[model samples]
Target chain A: MSEPISGKSLHGHLDTMVLAVLDKSEAHGFEVWKRLEAQAKGGLKLKEGSLYPALYRLETAGLLTARKEEDDSSRRGPRRRIYKITRKGKRRLDQGRQEWQHFVSVVECVIGAPA
Target chain B: MQDLRVHVEKAVRPVVADQGTKLRMREELYSHLLEVFEEERATGDDEAAAILRANDRLGDPAALTAELQATASRVSWYEGAIDRIVHRQDETEIGHACRLASRYLLAIVPLIIVVVPTVWIIQTLIGSTQKSFLDLVSDSLWFGVPFGVFATAQVFFFTIIAHRMLRQFDKPSWRPRSIGGVFGLCAVSTVFLLVSSFALFSILTGNPRATYELMMPKWLIASSLMPFVMTGFVLARRREIERLEPWSSLEIADET
Candidate 1:
């Protein structure tokens, strides 16, 4: 066998997971962090520093754009900068999808010995 | 429509900058969420809660804005260019006035170079031996007459440009009262540059008392240094003066 089987190990794969979630719909900083936290399934965690930096990099690469907007939940309307995916971001998400599929298939190819 | 706009704003307005994009996103998302809200309404839902739920379903505002911004970059770069194009009447007027003033000065200044020297040589050669006030008057008037006339024309033209510039700003009436100040500045500087340039030429060509030379070269001191220094002043101040006033005509609170 050339691989090991693990149910959930998404922490190291935060970028892919974060992007996959975004591929479904646009989200804010807190929403994205919360969604990724939930999807961890007990095996993934994202630090604010890590998640924010990844967001910033994706933004700088023409894959994302950002602007300030009022969050309305504000007792006082502090600015919240929101990000959105571009066409390039969607293509990147598609490529991420393909990679994840390949990775899952590679693992599935080698992990069997009667259950 | 009001509820739809608010709901759409909550979902999409945070990300988009354009009125068209905001309206479009509002309509599209509202149509989709309207169905979901109606389902709750049919189940005896409260109006406010159903509307709130519809907005919630649209998802994170920050995420939406960011997505739109990202998409903006991918959209044709011309979209941003449209926002930058000047549409104000004041901008167009100022632009036109600047072009006219520039062309007028360019043509007149060269004319000054032509007419000034021809008159100077003729008057200098034909002068009386007398040094009386009338003779001095004639010497300079015959020579300085054309030069003085041209300078006067230049001052009037300078006043016109400065007055137009003053109009562009949305200040108190006191702003235009300073038009005379600009004219005074240009006039004084013209004198200083001319005197210094002529002093240099007088020293170089040996004190204006040397052998009488009828014809001077094209690159003589008055023509070269006078225009050069004066032009440096104009070119240096052109951009700053043009932008000295703010684009908006919004009035400010009076402190006086």
Candidate 2:
């Protein structure tokens, strides 16, 4: 089995990952984690603790907005804070995508494309 | 589920943020952990084992708290200054006491200015009668100069006493008690000064009844009102100190 992706390797890209997840649909903290994990296909071993600070950082930067909603589901818990990506977040995600593409191209130049 | 809540509380408890931010974090984190716990349970794990797995997934609480504090919203400069004054985390006890005493002395400066002139004028009017307007004006200036000097010296003496009393209480926790002690000392000193002044004036003029009739009622009124004034000042300052408490807690958490 391939090595699982560590949170340290994904540090700089967490914001982009969060914004991308929320951009598809606004979700609470747990759902956001679920979506990201689902998208990574079990390869990303995201530390649940790290996700929150990233969310808070993004919210502080005005890249997303969160509002508390009373959860009516059978599995009762505290009010869930629903996070929605802002227009700024989408713009940042686009910028991040371009940067990633450029980085990939630079790496491919050094080590040629796979056969 | 209760275990999950407890774990979340422990995780967020050390985060050095305002109440609103901390509360939000607690609720969100608890919600996230609860979901994780339920998922683990769904996989046929026992309740205790599920809690363990959920906690493990969340990672270390200390590392999480550090990150949360780093990413928390910034406090305004005014709030930060109040926190610094309230905690004085970097200052030695002696330094903090000196600063507090200096602030007390500085606040009393305007009160001294107003009181000294008023007292001089009142004394001059009461002392002189059956005299020309020119004589009255001259006597007022003569009384004002000496009274101003005396009042300044008296205030400086009291301030020094207050400073020394403050230095005795090395622990910050004793500050409120020390303030009350200082105010009580000032009240007692004011009454003592009034009695002494009365006795001195009687001796200098060579008439006890005349001195009492001329100065006793006025001085009594001024002395009686001083404690109330001091009480009001203390109450206002107490309110400001209370307002600093929440921010003070953040500073305390940061130190830990």
Off by over 4 Å in 2: A71-73, A113-115, B76-255
* Per-residue lDDT of model 2, residues B1-256, tens digit only: 6567666666666665554566677777877888898899999999999999999899877788777877865552223333345445556545555554444444455555676566567766898545655565576556554454455445545445544454434443545456667667667767766876676676556798999999998898888776665455555545444434333334222233
Say what the interface RMSD of candidate 2 is: 0.7
Give the alpha carbon lDDT tens digit for every residue of B1-256 in model 1.
3464454455443443343443434434444455546656787879988776655655545555554444444232233333333222355544544444444444456565676566555666687333454555565555454544444455544445454544433444223345565455555555654554444445445554341232234334453454344445555555444433221232323201
Tell me each candidate's TM-score: 0.30, 0.54
Which ten residues in a row are the worst by lDDT in model 2 chain A? Answer: A70-79
Best by lDDT: 2
- Say what the interface RMSD of candidate 1 is: 13.4
Report the lDDT tens digits of candidate 2 across residue range A28-70: 8989998998998998987797899999889989999998786
Computed on alpha carbons, the lDDT of every model, listed in order, comes to 0.51, 0.71
Output the worst ten-in-a-row residue range by lDDT, candidate 1 chain B: B247-256
| Docking quality (DockQ) for each candidate | 0.02, 0.57
- Residue B65 miss distance in model 2 (angstroms): 1.0
lDDT of 1 by residue, A1-115 (tens): 3333232344446556667777767776656765765765544432232345466557767777777555465322223456678889889888988988898888887784347
